[model samples]
Target: MSRSPSIPDRPHRDIDSDLPDDERLEALRGHYEDLVDVNDQLSEQLDDAEDRRERLREKVDRVERENETLKSSSLYIATVEDVLDDQVIVKQHGNNQEVLTDVSSRIGDRIEPGDRVAVNDSFAIQTILNTETDARAQSMEITAKPAVTYADIGGIDEQVREVREAVEQPLAEPELFDEVGIDPPSGVLLYGPPGTGKTMLAKAVANETDATFIKMAGSELVRKFIGEGSRLVRDLFEMARERQPAIIFIDEIDAIASRRTESKTSGDAEVQRTMMQLLSEMDGFEARGEVRIIAATNRFDMLDRAILRPGRFDRLIEVPEPDRDGREQILQIHTRTMNVADGVDFADLADDTDGYSGAEIESLATEAGMFAIRNDRNEVSHQDFTEALEKIEKDDSSDVISSAGYFYQ
Candidate 1:
């Protein structure tokens, strides 16, 4: 029945095959285009996911580095609570771990004070605490300036000039050396009678240059501990090199630098070792940037011969006892604040002092004034100086001459 019904409607004509070539071709092309579009969209989505993963990984890496830095720093903390006297404290969050420290920290100092520090296991932020001694140690590292100055000292003009030229000028005007075509003198030595202003001259150099001044007695460098003294010598030179335009003032250098006797014991050998270290430091290499050494001694002859060699302690200057003019100047300077008789001629007083050093003159002037004050006199007179001189002569035989009657020879 169904076939008959279809035949009744087929009156109009040319029959086509059930599978038409054009229609099938069109359908297959459309299906292939849709698959290609789907693949492209999937590729785009995968690319975006990969980019997001990389970004996350970078953030994790940055956090890891910060956490590691915090763990390594002693001042790291888990929770930031407060800062007290250069100390930082942290309380751990959701964990029993604690950290504490008294060390100072700043922005770039690699410290972390929060739970964000947990990213690094190597360094952990545990707790916060204070070490008063450590705080004090950090505070005490300030370098103090040299206290003595040219104005504070009494005499020694030549010595000051030599230091200014050989040391101060060399540091301040390096171009001058090349311009003048003259190599600066290698070194300057201050040798004099006791209390003749040698040490004062060195201190004045430190003050004039406004340089970092490191002062050490010769005996301090002669440590009983083996190798310690030599090591300190090396450290001192290195520190001076680091702090350029620095002055190293060594007082009583004759104690460690005395004439080298034949070795007697290990102690002597150690002392020689220290001296050798100092020698090497003085002349080891090229012209250093801005470091000058000023050494003082009452006995120049007592220093080791090697120390006086060329290129090392090359200039030997005598800070001698004050002459008449020098004595007058020194007396005048010391008596600036004192009440003195108008007839008290410092010229006559200086003429009476032949072998006195500047220090001796100052002491004498002070003694005279003190005597006047003790007797309730308003002015220091020549007679008071004579009496004071007698009293000092009685006290020490070294002061055997009376002020006016006998001149020291």
Candidate 2:
């Protein structure tokens, strides 16, 4: 241990008796000044020493706390299986060991069956843990509303109407359904070819409503470990139930809800199990209050019949490629923010881009803008659009040729 340097003693007031009176007074004044300076130095040293002692004491306390923490037994997570008069049964996670343990009086009244509790090595309940949704499930929740809106989507008006009636109407106007004495549609399934605004439709719904939106891909539910996928599904639905008036949009749903086969493979079996849990949650014995489901898939035929039933997916809306008018509308919507020259005619462009989906029209508009930029122009022109269409057609033909070559090989 280090010790503080000792402070010097105060200077004594001493003067020669034979000195002149003025000189003696001057000597006494000098002594007084020196004593004052010495006192200030000592005071500074004392303050510094006290500060150092306090810091050291705090450090020692922190170290002692850490040491105690290290010496304490680790707490294990366990679920309360049953609660009796004097004791509670807890099954430890991972080990699956059930132990009947006495609960502390402080938390005895709070402990209940199905509650997750922290227990010590001796199986003594330490504290009750709050129910936690799986982090994976929580991440799927859309905290920020999607920027896409119904106005941004084109060529899917009827499909959008069906979706709103199935999903948004019930959430916004439950009294209407109640007045009619009928239950609202439980879920909506969007099936169509690629790039036909299926996802944008879902996003439009998400943006149009104030309800909680939880979006996830079906591939995310296909877990490698058994029971994990099903647990995740359960957690997702439970979270939706907790956050009522919630909409769950599962994109590419055919990945997990594919037709079940008798393949005896573990991977297939796990996927089937997850699908079964999803089905039960969609239309189970217990009522799913204020929860709506929306799923989209390009391969609609691949989905299982069970998931396509009336109760599970009450509305099956098909979002196909845009017609000429729809394509023109989509083109106009995409280029609304762009600088276009007078020479560009949307009607002509829409006629030229036949069989194009809404997504393709948006891409065409983007490509046209790129062409204008390449030509060092500030505004898109009809010539630019013509060049862009030619390039896209060439690329499409090349892709078809490549596929054909691969198939022949």
Work out candidate 2's RMSD over C-alphas: 11.6
Candidate 2 per-residue lDDT over residues 328-400, each given as its tens digit? 8899999999999988899998898777767778888999999999999999999999999999898884354
How would you encode candidate 1's per-residue C-alpha lDDT over 92-167 as one tens digit per residue?
4333244454543542155544312322343333333333322212221213457767765555787777777887
Residue 128 miss distance in model 1 (angstroms): 23
List where candidate 2 sits over 4 angstroms from the true fold: 1-141, 223-227, 285-288, 397-409
Model 1 per-residue lDDT at 215:
64
Residue-pair clashes per prediction, in order, are 8, 0
What clash pairs does model 2 have?
none
TM-score for each model:
0.59, 0.65
- Model 2, total clashes: 0
Local distance difference test, each candidate:
0.65, 0.78
